[model samples]
Target: MSKAEKTKQHIIEKTATLFNTKGYISTSLSDITQATGLTKGSIYGNFENKDEVAIEVYKYNAGLLGKTLSRSFSDEYPKALDKLHAFVDFYRKNWKFVFSNGGCPIMNAATEADDSFPALKNQVKKSFELWMSKISTAILEGQKKGEIDKRVNAEQYASLFIMLIEGGILLSKTMGDQSFLNHALDKITHMIDHELNILPS
Candidate 1:
């Protein structure tokens, strides 16, 4: 990367947590300058405005979540059933990684960027779809490999799984209790053991 590219990335990385914790509406250019330690001209030189920075920050935060999923799929034995369990296990292991960084970016942005930020709203929507696709792909592989039941609908299960997870995170963050998220993941694990698994539990 060129010097300018590196500088822009430095700004994005520095202010990512601030954007995640503080909504785009509440976060100002001054906040970016404070977090990044960059002058106003430097900030504006890299980004057209706070809105542009927010969009990149959203992508940066979302990439963290993608990494969580990526690691979840990296197993010695990557069966479909195991992958499903890993989905739960990922959040189980990364609760602090997520909660400390101001909760799930898609969830945070989706709730905050409704009528005002169309571009951000679209970004969140695409992220949701991408996450759901990942789940569905795992389910399909499990079904084909005889690890998961063929009768279960992959897309339907994917949506349900995400709904439970996101709801759990929302509650956990709001109540300052990890149990809510843990309980949701526990429920998914149970569903995998009984409803989805073709292997004996």
Candidate 2:
């Protein structure tokens, strides 16, 4: 890549945690300069404004999460049901990575961007839509394979899963207890095995 492209990526990478942790409003130009070791002029040269940088930082953080979760579904999770279980288990396995990166980017952004940052809020909404679509598609695929119950509402289940997981994350993070998330995942697993899973004759 070109020098400018590399520099822009560097800024994004450097400021990702700052933006996620400090938030859009709280992360000042001075903070960006300090985090990226770039002067204000240099930062503006790369990004149109603080808002642009914030948006890009959000994308960078959220993209890393999306890519990581997508990577969880490999040959080990060939079956749709297996993929669902893997999805639930992924949070438990990767909690360290998530915590290190400043919590779930989507959830963090959603909570902060609701009314204040319209642009970032829109991105968060899109991220959630895409996430829900992925879950619903998986449910649909499982139904086609006769592994999931046809009676299950794919969209509803997808929404429910997000609600449980996000809420669990919020509670767990607030309480400094991982058991909340663990309990939520356990409930999801039970729902999948009993409510969604189709028993073989």
Candidate 3:
């Protein structure tokens, strides 16, 4: 990468962590500068303003999530059921990072940007849709392979899984208890298995 691109990526990485920890509203320009060790002029030179940095940080955070999910699906788990398990396992292992200081960036941005920033809110919504679509596709694939019950509705079940996960994460964060996540995962796993006509082991 070029120097400018490298610097821009550095700024985005630093800001993403800050935003995830301190929140978009709470993370100030000073925080970004301090974290990045860049002056106000340098920060502005790279980004137009705090909002611009925040938007880029949100995208960076989303990209990180996508990469993690992608890495979980390897050739060893080519089957849809195995792929689904891998996806859930990824979240289970990374619960700490996923539910860090400020919680899910998508949820945070969705709530904060709704009335304040429509454009950012739209991006958050699109990210959610993408997640749901992926899960739905997996369900459909499993159904085709006879691993998942053909009677079950892929889109509906996918929505349920996503909603349950997001809700569970929020609840876990609010209660400051990781066990909530375990319970939530248990419920979701059972739901998926039951829908697939398989008893949960």
Winner by lDDT: 1
- lDDT by residue (1-201, candidate 1, tens digit) is 999999999999998899999886789999999998989999889889889999999999998788778665566538878778877988999888899999999999999999899999999999999999888988898888888899999999999999999999999999999999999999999888998998658
Whole-model Cα lDDT per candidate?
0.89, 0.88, 0.80
Among all windows of 10 consecutive residues in model 3, the one with the lowest summed lDDT is 192-201
Q: Could you tell which candidate, 1 or 3, scores higher by lDDT? A: 1
lDDT over C-alpha atoms for residue 28 of model 2: 97
Task: At residue 28, give the lDDT of candidate 3.
Answer: 91
List candidate 1 stretches off by more than 4 Å: 74-76
Q: Where is model 2 poorest over a 10-residue stretch in terms of lDDT?
A: 69-78
> What lDDT score goes with residue 115 in model 3?
79
- Clashing residue pairs for model 1: none
Please give the lDDT score for candidate 2: 0.88
TM-score each candidate. Answer: 0.96, 0.96, 0.91
Q: Per-residue lDDT of 1-201 in model 3, one digit per residue for the tens?
A: 998889999999877878877777778989998999989998998888888888889998887787777765556677877777787887699998787646777887877788787767877988988888787888788778777878888788778877777788888898998887787788777776666644344
Better structure of 1 and 3 per TM-score: 1
Superposition error at 185 for model 1 (Å): 0.6
lDDT of 2 by residue, 6-39 (tens): 9999999999999988887689999999998999
Task: Supply candidate 1's per-residue lDDT for 166.
Answer: 96
Candidate 1's displacement at residue 100, Å, is 1.0
